[model samples]
Target: MRLTILAPLVAALFIAFTQPAQAERVDSGVPGMLFDHDVPVAMNDGAKLSINIYRPDKPGRYPVLMLMGPYGKDTTMADAPAYRTSWAKLIAKYPDLCKKSSCRYIRFEAPDPERWVPSGYVVIHADVRGAGASPGVLDPFSPRETQDYATLITWAAHQPWSTGKVGLLGTSFQAINQYQVAALRPEGLAAILPWEGAFDQYREIAYYGGILNVAWQFWWEHQVVPNQNGNAGTPLIDSIGGGKDTGLPLSQERLKDNRIDPVGAFARHPFDDAWYHERTPDGRRITVPLLDVANWTDWSTQGYLAAASRQKWLRIQTGDHLTPFYSDQALALQKRFFDHFLKGIDNGWEQEPRVAVQVRHRDGTTWRNEKAWPLPDTNWEPYYLDAASGSMGPTFEAAAPAAKSWPGLGEGLTFTTAPFVNETEFTGPVALRLWVSSSTADMDIFAAVRLIDPEGRDVTFMGNSDPNVPLDLGYLRVSHRAVDPANSTAWQPFHPHVAAEPMTPGQLYPVDVEFMEPTSIVIPKGYRLALTIQGTDFGYGPGAPIVHAKDYDLPDDSHSGLFFAAHPNRDPALYGGTDTIVTGGKHASYLLLPHVPPRS
Candidate 1:
């Protein structure tokens, strides 16, 4: 603390002596920057919203850039007593952005006005309703909030300073809402840079492969939601309803009413009933050019990558979730995109490739460039699941055989591979063909594909969320394997995922499961890959962060715990029995990989 106090003063002296006193003057209302006024924008509802507008004084008229978030609009560092003391430290590195255009309307998570205003742009930040000064229910990420998004874009489009071309930029929830609003097709909504956002609430937030994600959801409600309203120590000093969401304090009844039981919502609709159907972003409805960003380490949905890959203009990047927001390269890309789309500037952004992915490198740094998503000429190869030695490989020639292993705790099966010494790239989606037997009516197969090193080590790569994640895994319940043949083909495997059908004690049936898409990873010169087959659900670590819901928690059960019944909910000790044993020999099994040819 003591050193920091003297450090800035000493640095000032060093700067004055080492170089010219004025290195880069910024206009943030500081010696290096400037400020602007807080303008009020009216929403469709009676509630009013406040905006902190940032612009350069020397500009006649400039293209406007806008951001809408639940954070406060007036809560810039200019008013925070503690923030002022620490402002210089942050401003030191970002002098121009922190000081831009008199700094009147500065907010976090935005490029400094001094950086963009001089480039002929006006930045506007809006505090979402139920936050800052806007009024109404604080049900965040709701259709209501999304409706207001379209309204704001249209409102911003007509502003005197705006060119009727407004683009959106933000990360996390900020970016997710852009996808939702864009689906609405607002009149003036031009483009968007949606980064690290998942569109499906079911897969992204509520559940993963039918497992409840209570961890992040619980924390979000506790810490993030409260401040979203006019809570203490929040950014954006303005309140909803022009201070109503903040005025005379919100009623506890109203606050309580806004609380959402996310788990309960999902529990009610085990299928695509009403709740989930309403929450999912209508991707088919979205028709805007997007600079979509994604990270493998993002626990959020990678569906956007799949969604944008289908679009004409998209950039699917891979890095730590937060890297692109602050990285020079990402910012430069965003600047150029918005400059071309919103400002009508011919910045050559249109000629940029349709997809820009960071081909992951072994080291932390990534190789980035333009290419077709799923790389056009992918090799769709299939490897089978042999129920012996618990392996995954291709079936050569199938000979008559006895019944395979049971569902749970039974013999795991087998297959083989002519080990490849050359490196091969596997990109795109994966599929599985399984012939199984069961003693009961239903069965669940936990199928995971892994790369086994020549040294017999399980190869784990950075997944969409975890660095130690496996290559690819797919789940299937025997009865639920009924595919929508109309939608089911080779590349896309559509499952009904509806009811559970019991299996004949010794009947043999074929089950097909498709693994979600993953980028290519070189299998190195000498490596043998393997797949894990199990009946039990997959959960790791102290908390086991994932919880799968089953008929065991149905209305008749009403509660969750160890099961002890039969008929409907069978007793595990008796009929709940399963044969998870795997047996492999000859041409019984194999794994299919969509292999991409090595870069020339």
Candidate 2:
């Protein structure tokens, strides 16, 4: 935790000049855009949070697009090495990314001020308390942080340069908080666009089907801690303030005392209890106009469906997460959405289709607009798994009872469908119903829906972080198989991870595993669809190894880097052993897919 220290006199000098609540105006580097640096907005608790504003130089009144998060407002995309490398690769791939705008003044995962300011919008980036220039405890997504956001939304709306209408926009962390504060129905909050942001903290992120995802621990340690407000060693320099220090430096012990350990909190509360509920958004209360964007390769799907807004739309696109957000086409779509909602323009946006899906095929992608998600004409088909021949078909083969056994830490089994007789499309939610027995007290199940080409090669796509990701993935721990009947649907089963019911060794138990997100892929006449059942995380070759020695052991290079769901912390005595999948006259193990017919 040691950081680069400044001389005592120099440190004191920097604090005296930088910690004040004065606003400094400067050239925004982008033509026609003005920068207001270190603008402080008072929170309800009397603490002033720092915000940097970017707007048209001669703005009368314009709609506001605000992005608030722990990622420092002064931190440009190039400030973080990881982001810088990714941005370079993205630019190399998509040459037209920055054609319309200069791409300058773009913060990580936030909107580019250069792009939006010239579009008659005021762009504001606020630092969450305890991060960047804001001062307070650095507890992210807590009730206090949510309240600060709501207050800021209202404050921005009433500003002299604002049209009294504010719309929320950004990706990931920036998009996540929009759901929380929007639930409060703050005044002048016109609309929100949450792109690839997880809604349910417990199910979607912390615990994936009751299996702990260790990525959050890595995220906090590697990405978050270094950017705390008082860290002099923060790589980010104030680009707007002529390369000044982002914040005053604080002692290591003081920094540690100022922030709560999120990973520890997650370990303590494994269930979907009040602590998680407090952080998750109550979508029923969100009545603002909403445009929820999802990536075909990411795991954020529930926000649009959960929102109660009458004027809501879902746009599911393809490609890696951050790249798509800054693409030319995505920018146009975002501008159209904001123009209709925030600017009160009659742009016929309301008349457009409610759902837009990019149907992917081996050749390319086809954009299709639908009236609703899961398509009204979705044919929910079940392909029964036959363990005897490792095959899957529509009808269950009424043969003698059979079972397939695989070690808990090994590559389990794959059931392949006979090649498609006709070009077929499967483009929505997927589920798996299985009857299983574990040699140990409990077992972890990892299921992947994949595509096999006519040449017998595995078809993979670029995931949010992983370069090779399957069509869809699902996970379930036998101990946490208790389903909530009220929330469970035919295609999606909702598991209430409140209590863990240990499985009796050698006894069969039926469980429905729900894929975290929907997928869209079109199979050619000869292409085949496959279902892989495994114990550990799904990977390219032999898959992730089960290491019981260390609790926080990360996956090797062979596994999906950030998206791997390996539960190393679980007791080996209880989870290690052989797992059996039985399919016969009564067991009826099957894979459920959404078969969408082509539009006329």
Candidate 3:
């Protein structure tokens, strides 16, 4: 009886292993459209990666638009359970999302094949080395992954029914890798569009001013791990056929062994080092034409300015990161860009303005085109801080030195400006200089620029991910305050973050904090601009709480999902002490803002 029982179980396992894998051919549900899934492309190391192709059924040769990322290429927007809420909100806000096509075939943060294929383009999506259907070790944005992306680009260019030119398109993760691969200057790469993606891995995301963003732990556990290759119970299933979208299943222990722990890596390396340098893009090496789209409240313009591309354009828009990329207006802009660069259509794209900004006002936003960033005629003005009266103003008059103190881990201080007498527009980078002292050896400073209405209500806007966000934000750890003199500018201070210089307790030191990203706001008459200097993460107002990383806990009174700088491993003895800000006479502290003048 024991032999009989064992024989059946062994037979079942043998049969499961003997069956051939299913072919990935399905009707694209669109006239004259062909869908080819799981096309293999080999790397130099003999590792095979998979890609999905959507092209016109009668195509001879066409320019290619590609997206390569860890997000599953096989997972459709309508079928992805993880993005259910985001998809619903997208549809509710933009009902015309399906007017061009059913929108069922569009992958998350990727282009809709139905929209591009009919317009004489071949759209392709690839599963990065160790995600989705591809099988390998999972390491995101690694040098090895960048190499594989370059290899894929060459492969797409030489395909039987493809043009030699390929253009990169997508949002967020899809866009982040574009910068890295483009730096390689790979063959057949015609152009790139990096939208709302950070170029500096260390400064922009992992460690904001030397303070670790623990929310990355949540991002890895929730968004990335579930879609990792060989994950056993991935919720993402093939929309055309009901089955797992990832590869064969692996045990939880095996899965853990095959991937790098991003959070653990971040904890080990607190400074900018070789590990981050290997992952970040060297913009000087990127020579392809570029169209960099930045959200007004999200990423910065550093990457755009660093690129060596002579034919480059910048468009700054106001909206959450994902919505604007798929809007009808944005879609048209992308098509026109690709049509000129990839197809050599001569669509007058070269004549387009170098900078396009959607200037945010009290009621809404307005469009403005300029020849360059920071507006050539910008008036760099200093607003002096007054510690005695908790006020900030344009003029600086000598007065007796004064100081204000607050708990290091509590709501610190707010210096408000008198209500404006005229409509004032602040349309560029911002910097904050402060003379600070801590009771302990070190402290962290969190600064935010906020708008106050005539009725004293705080004005907020929808950020990249969070609904309620301030005008702009900056952070600095007093210990890691060394600035790179070569890169330091009046409008922006570049921190090398190479070493930590612990502070002498109660000894005042001046630190300049750059607001990393730019903002465009028009303050109307009777409105006040306030700067809040705090020790903890900026709190969110009443609205839908940041749901993306809600599982992560914050400090007692602080609540934030994005731009979270509260480190879990920080020592209370070192950072949880009283903090002081000094201002007046010799110790002058002020906020530097870029004031743009009206066009002639």
lDDT of each: 0.54, 0.80, 0.81
Which regions of candidate 1 fall more than 4 Å away from where they truly are?
1-40, 71-115, 203-205, 230-248, 297-311, 364-371, 395-419, 435-447, 462-467, 476-479, 496-509, 535-590
Tell me the lDDT of model 1 at 149.
Answer: 69
Candidate 2 wrongly placed segments (more than 4 Å): 1-21, 96-99, 242-245, 542-557
Per-residue lDDT tens digits for candidate 1, residues 101-141, read 55554444444455666677777776677665555566666
Model 1 has an lDDT value of 0.54
* Model 3 residue 395 lDDT score: 63
Ranking of models by lDDT: 3, 2, 1
Could you give candidate 2's per-residue lDDT for residues 1-600 as a string of tens digits? 000011011211112221224678876667788888878877656787899888898949999999898877776666675478667756876787677666667777888888788889999899999988888889978877887787787778777788989999998888888988887677778999999888888888788888887777767776677678787776666665645334678888989898877867878888888888878878887789999998776647688988899999998877678877887788888999999998888999988789989888875688998989878999999899999999998866575578999988876899999999998999999889999999998999988888887777777766676656778888898898999899988899999899989899999999988577888988889989889998887777544322211132233354553455544466777677899999978998999889998779
Please report how far candidate 3 places residue 85 from its true position, in Å: 1.8
Query: Which candidate number would show the highest TM-score if scored against the true structure?
Result: 3
Give the Å error, residue 510, model 2. 0.3
Ranking by TM-score: 3, 2, 1
lDDT for each residue of candidate 3 in 1-600, tens digit (9 for 90 to 100): 111111112211112212222336678889988988787777767787888888999949998999998878878766676677668768977998888788878778888899999999999899998888899988888877887787777777777677789999999888888988888766779999988887888888788888887877776877778889999798878775568877899999989888887878888899888888877777777789999998767675767987889999998887678878888888899999999999999888999899999988876788999999878889988898999999998865464688999998876899999999989999989999899999999999889898888777767776777666678888898898889989988988999887899999999999987578888898899989989998888776445233211122322224433677656657878888999999988899999988998666
Better of 1 and 2 by TM-score: 2
